[model samples]
Every structure is written in C-alpha cells, then in structure tokens.
Target: MKPLSTIVQAITGCLLIISCNHTPRARTVQVQSSANESVKDYPSHPKTAEELRQELAETEAADPAGMLLISGTMQENKILIQKPDLFHHSKYATDGYMISGIIRNKASIAPFKDAIVRVTFYTETRTELDHKDYPVYKYVLAQQVTPFELKVYPPESTKDFNMEVVSATAIRN
Candidate 1:
C-alpha cells in the first residue's frame, strides 16, 4: 500500500491540476449566466438612455467592479498565456520570483487598448500571497499578442500564480 503522506500529496496535486485547468470559455459562460441572473433581478426598466446610464451607475456603486463589467458592452477577452516562465530571484523571500509570458489576443476582433493584466500569487495551500496589475502596451491589436515581464519583489509566500486580463477598454475601429 502507498504511504499515507504520499497518497495525500498525490490527491492534493490532482486537485491543483484540476482547478488550474479551467478554460476561458467555461469562465465566460459562468460569468454570463451569473450576469443574467443579476440582470433578471434588477427592479425596473429605464425609459431613457440617460436613465439606463443612471441605473448602471447605481448598480456599479453597489458592486463596484462586477456590476460595471456585467452591464458594459465589452465582450469577454481570451488572453492566452504563452511560454510562461517563472524563476526564483532571491533566497531570502520565499516568493521572490520573476514571471515572463506572452499574452495573446485569442478570442476577440474588437481592439482593446491599455488593459490591466493582473497576476495573483498563491501559496502551496492555495492561500493568496500577493497580486499586482500591469497595463498592457498602448494596444493589443486584434489576432496578435504582447509579451510582458514582471518581477514580484516581495511575493510573501507564493508557490503558484494565476494570470488574467482583468479589465480593458474596447475600442471600435
């Protein structure tokens, strides 16, 4: 029989792999469903565009980040992480590391400019260590990609990290 500790480690590793493998499409579907529910629960309809704007403003005031994204016209972006490399930079800080990756615009034709890309570092136990957001270049053109490099100076106690394109302004051509 396998040792208890070894079995536990294997199970933990499997769970981590499963959690990290969520596709962006699945996440978008989830967000759309949740947004649908929230919109269904909104009390009234606005007669004018200005009133619609006011309603959105009030909703955003209630849930600053989520409501704006849900009510906005922007579509979900597929920011693919390509060739991500993380390396330890210092011996003193347990989470001292540098990460470099290429973020590709996989699923959009609507050009986005100056989007905020965020990385959240987590410990082995899945505890949040640190998070930082950086702006992409002036524009991430349609069907193209951008390379980025960032260092986590004081990563606290990170063992893993997740990168995301959190927010971006979509521009019409």
Candidate 2:
C-alpha cells in the first residue's frame, strides 16, 4: 500500500511538471489600423515671431470671425462678451440682478462650447459682493455667437457688477 501511494504521488508530480513545461502556441492575430484618410499628419517646425504674426494675420483674414481655428490651442482673451445688458431687477417674489449678453468666439477658426461666462457683482467701492457664472449652450460653433443670461443674488452692499468670459471650453467628440 505504501509503495502504491508513493507511486500515485510521483505520477501526480510528473503530471504537474508536464503541464507546467507546456508552452502556449504563438497566435497570429491580424490588427486593423484606425487611421483616417482625410486626416494628415504634418511635420512640426519652428518659425520666427514675424512668420507667426504673418500666419496669424493670414488666418485672421481668411476667417475674420475665427470660426475654423483649433479651439483648444487658442490664446487667452480670445472670447469677447459683446453688447452685454446688465441691470438690477426687483420683483415681488424675487429681487436680484440680471445679466444678459452675447459671447462671441474671436478665434480665427476654433469653435467653443460649454463656455463659462462670469459676472462679478461689486459695491459702490468696487468691493466684491457676489459672482455668478453662466454656461453657454451646447456648441458655440466656430466664429459663432451665443447668448447667456444670469440672475445673481447680490449682497446688500451690491451696487454694480462686471461681466466677462471666465473661460470657454471646447467640445470634444
């Protein structure tokens, strides 16, 4: 019986060793590339300030409204709050300040979406009272103009407010 048990153990060990020594066969899987034919990769090169300025000028001229440029790489202060209408309103149920305005993307080609339009309320001494931000609609397409409305509940010392584009985020699909 002892010899039989030893033989069984040795057989189990040999089976384990055989299984462990087996190597998986290499697989020849075909991979598909996801490169788009319409998109081309251009080599990057450094340019002088004058060259950059000239290129910017050309871009600006080609698309004066800047509706077709790269949205993410646009420089700061490219968003313009055009013809903002700010006024204080008081009603029986609610009393606060109202801000309505149009935000325009001054980019040469980039479109902005989900832009944050901020209005900062201040007192007579320009003391910060309250600040509120309103988000622009779905897609403020390239060279596109979008309107925003915000109702701010100002503090008692609120006397005036200023509106500006806090930040504009570009939409990515």
Query: How close is each model in CA RMSD to the real structure?
Result: 27.1, 17.0
TM-score versus the correct structure, for each prediction: 0.42, 0.44
Model 1 lDDT per residue over 66-105, tens place: 2112111111222334444485332221333556666555
Off by over 4 Å in 2: 1-91
TM-score of 2: 0.44
Clashes of 2: 9
Regions more than 4 Å wrong, model 1: 1-96
Top model number, lDDT: 2
All candidates' lDDT scores?
0.56, 0.59
Clashing pairs in 1: none
